[model samples]
Target: MKILVLSNMYPSPAHKTFGIFVKNQVEALKEAGHEVEVIGITNPLTGKKNVISKYLRWITETKMKLIFSGRKYDVIHAHYVFPTGLLALLFKKITGKPFVVTAHGGDIDRMAKKNPKIRQWTEKILQEASHVVAVGEALYQEINEDYQISKDKLSIINMGVNRDVFKAYPKKKIRRELQIPDGVEPVVFVGNIIREKGLSELVEAFKTVKEKRPQVELYLIGASRNQAYREELNQLMGTGVHFIEPLPQKELAKWMSAAEVFVLPSHIEGFGLVAVEAMSCHTPVIGTEVGGLRYLLRDGSGVLVPAQQSARLAEAIITVLENDDLKQQLIEKGEQKASENDEKKMIAKLERIYQQIS
Candidate 1:
């Protein structure tokens, strides 16, 4: 099958960590024996648009790309609704192809709520689509509650972790390399530093956790998408809180293996990719109960706390830290569950989608 993979979410040369999910999906589709051509876009300014250019570029580049591509695609798979869905919708009208829409979280939750115009565009795309895919149940419900998309049109495809790459490593060696003390228990949070990521709340919780367990260390990984957010977090850095920018995907796996506890306090997440990656490395995760975490994390894997509740987050951290046997049990169980969501199986399901839509 010849597939045209459309995404306004993908990593760029400059910004490597931005929506690597689309990139991962594209590669998976190709590995499944589907001939895929990507029509992916990155923010030219990396999300600092002056408003006028943001709207104009969507029509100009996104719509224009489909019109002039010359080669037709059997399946048009659009990732995230904002610009990708809009462009895919326009192409569907022009070429009469089977369009598939994938809803990422912000589009269904925030953008759909704030912009009626974009919401209408997204609904038209979802309603008319041959199929829809969402990474999480929250996003699936968000789209279904507001739109008239049929039940048959939707499916869930988890973005899987590469287990071999994230498997267990020498934790003591890693800790020594990073100069972290043997006595300190490192609680690692891996994701972009943004408003919705809940890093500020993580810091607050860490402060309280420090009051009780002085040896408790907080490690903040990943790049800060917002300068102000980075600055706000800087005050807490190096005072039992260590800040590190985004590392290569390979290095991140090593870091995950080193940490005693993994925490993702994201207010919104389509799928907690990093959390699962940690689980694959036999690291116990503690994430917000909201979004895809509820579906991905069972009771055996880790603890789930309410969103934006730093106190509960802290309590959960402490609970895991105090219980050595529980931590080991969660790690053993999480590793077993994490192995179930493999790229090969996910790609196989995607192949079926391609064949059906084609």
Candidate 2:
């Protein structure tokens, strides 16, 4: 089968970590014996939103590529529902190809709520697609509630963690490479440094944890290119609190291996991919009971706290860090859960979806 993968959220030479989940699925499809062609826009180092020029470039490129290319696609798989799916909808009209759109949170929750015009378009896109994919069950429910997409047309298939890159490593070796001090338990967070990720609340919670456990350290990974948010988090980056720029997947897995616990306090997440990766590294995770975390951290595999509640988050972190039995249990169960969502399983599910849609 041939697939045309469409999205604006693809990684480029400038920004390597951008929508890498979508890229992973594309690669998986290729490995599964499906031919795949990608048509998308890549952002600059700043990671800015699409402008008028970008929109024009994307549509024009899509038309030129599909028309000029000799190969015909069996399915058009688009990540993100609004504009990228909208473009796919246009291409479908032209080529008479069936398309599937994957809703990755922001489009359904944020953009749909911000403007009626986008909401209406997104509704049409969801309704018209041959099939839809939601990264999490919460988002799947939201899509059903909001747009009334039929059960047969939608499925929950999360982005998988690469076991090769995210598997466990020797903690001491990784800690030495990272230059983390001995005798200090590291609590880590890896994501965009933004408000919605609950960075402020995380800092507050860490402060509380610090009072209880003096030997622990906090490491904030990922890009801090958002100057205002970075500045806001500046005062808290002292003593045991550390900030590191975004590391590649292998490096991040080492950090996860070194960490005593991985904390994700995001108010909203399409899918908590990083938490799964951390779990795959035998690192127990403490995440907010919101969005994908509810599903990802199931069956006591990892600790989940209420979103934006610094006190609860702090308590959960402290409990995980202090209790050896609980930590070991979480690590053991988390590894099992992580294995269930491996790339092979996810790709197999996707192959079924593609067959259904095609």
Candidate 3:
């Protein structure tokens, strides 16, 4: 099948971890014998002027591609619902082809709530799409209840873990490769370093944990789009915290493997993909009981704490670090959970969806 993928978030040279799941999905589809073409926004710049110009250029490029590409695609798949789906909707209307849109959390939880106009557009986009994929079960329920999208048209399908790249490695070897010192328990977080990701809360929690276990170190690994927020976080976090830039998947997998525990304190997440990757690397996860994390970490798979509660977050971290039995149990269960969302299975499910719609 020939597929055209439209996504507003795609990895650039500078920000390779940004929207990396979308790139992985595209590559998986190609390996499965499907022809795929992508039109994505690769710039990781911020600021009002840059944002406006970036979208303007993206719109112009998408319009040209739809107009001039003589080879018709079997289906159009969009990542985000509002802005990116707008282009897929346009192509579908002009050519009478079916389109699918995957709602990756913020589009519904944040973007749709921004204004009445965007909310209305998001609803229309979901309504018009041939199928909709919600990356988490909570998102599936939200779209059904809040957006009034039919259950028949919506499915819960996470961007699964590539076990081949994320599998467990010897902790000592991985730590040495990454230059991580021995005798220090590293608690790692891999996502955008922003306020919404609960970085402030994580820093405060880590401070409490560090006092109890001086050997524990916190690693914040990802790009910081907001300069002011980054500065504020830097001020809040003193010694014992390492701010590393976003890394590619292979390197990130090594960090995950080397860590004592992986933490994701996001206020909202469509799906905690990083947590699953950590699980695949035999690293236990500690996440907030919000959004996808609630579903992902349920039933002894990983430790869960309330969002914004540094006290609870600190307690969970300490418990995981101190109790060897609990940590081992979490690792075993987390690996099971990760196996259920394997990339090969996910791509096959996606292939079936494309076939059904086309």
Candidate 4:
């Protein structure tokens, strides 16, 4: 199969971590013996304010590349729904090509909700796609209901964990490199440092957890680009709270394996990919009950508390840490759950989707 990947989220020298899952999927496709090419709207990982200019760049780049390239692709795969996928739709109109759209949250959940015009436009794009891929069940259901997309046209396929990169590492060696004391129990949180990510609640919960277990340390690992929110989080960090800049995937896996527990206190998650990555390291995850976390952490695989409830999040974290039997149970089950969403399985499913559409 020959595939052309269209997205605004793909990684570049400027933004190494931007739309990394989409990059991973493209890599998996290539590894599976499919020829793939990508034409994306190149921009900074952050500080991208001119949406109109970005769309114009994407349109011009895609048009120039498609017209000049001699290769004819069997399918065009899009990462986001509204703009990038809409670009695919435009290409199809021009060249009569088939295209697939993968909704990675935000486009449907955030952008669609921005106004009625975008909502209608996005729905039209989804309706015209050859097929639609939803990263989570919640988003899948939302698209099905909001846009009235048929079941035959839609499928829920999460961006899977890369087991090779995310599997367990030597915790002691990682701790040594990170300078984390051996006796301390570190709880890790990896994501954007934003208010919507529940960093405030995590900080509050850590404060409560500290009162009970003084040995507990909070390790926040992510890009602290939101300076105002970073200041707020700094105010909440009294002691035993360490903040580190975003590490690459290899380094992040080491930290994930080194920590006693991983927490995802997001107010809303499209797929909770970080939780799956943590589970791939055999680390117990404690996530809030909202969005995709509800399904991902379901069935006792990990701990879940009400969203934005600091005390409840604190209680869940304390229970997982203090209870040896439960901690082990979560670890064992987490490994199993992570395996289900491994790259191999996800890639195979995507291959099947491509075959179906082709």
> What TM-score against the true fold does each predicted structure earn?
0.92, 0.95, 0.98, 0.95
lDDT of 2: 0.87
What digit string (tens of lDDT, one per residue) describes model 4 on residues 207-255?
Answer: 9999999999999988776798899888888788988886788989999
Give me candidate 2's TM-score against the actual structure.
Answer: 0.95
lDDT of model 3 at residue 231? 95
Error of 4 at 318 (Å): 0.8
Q: Best-fitting candidate, measured by lDDT?
A: 3
Candidate topping TM-score: 3
Ten residues in sequence with the least summed lDDT for candidate 2 = 43-52
Q: Please give, for residues 15-68, the per-residue lDDT of candidate 1 as tens digits.
A: 777777678777777776778887665653455364456556655766676778
Which residue runs does candidate 4 get wrong by more than 4 Å? Answer: 45-53
Looking at model 4, how many pairs of residues clash? Answer: 0
CA shift of 282, model 3, Å = 0.4
lDDT of 3 by residue, 1-358 (tens): 9999999999878768778999999999999999999999998788899899989999999999888872498899999998999999999988888999999999999999999999999999999999999999999999999989999889988999999999899999989888888898999999998999999999999999999999999999998889999999989996799999888899899999999999999999999999999999999999999999999999999999999999999999999999999999999999999999999999988888998999
Model 1, poorest ten-residue lDDT window? 43-52
For model 4, give the 10-residue run with minimal summed lDDT: 42-51
lDDT by residue (84-140, candidate 2, tens digit) is 998789768888888999999988879888888988999999998999999898999
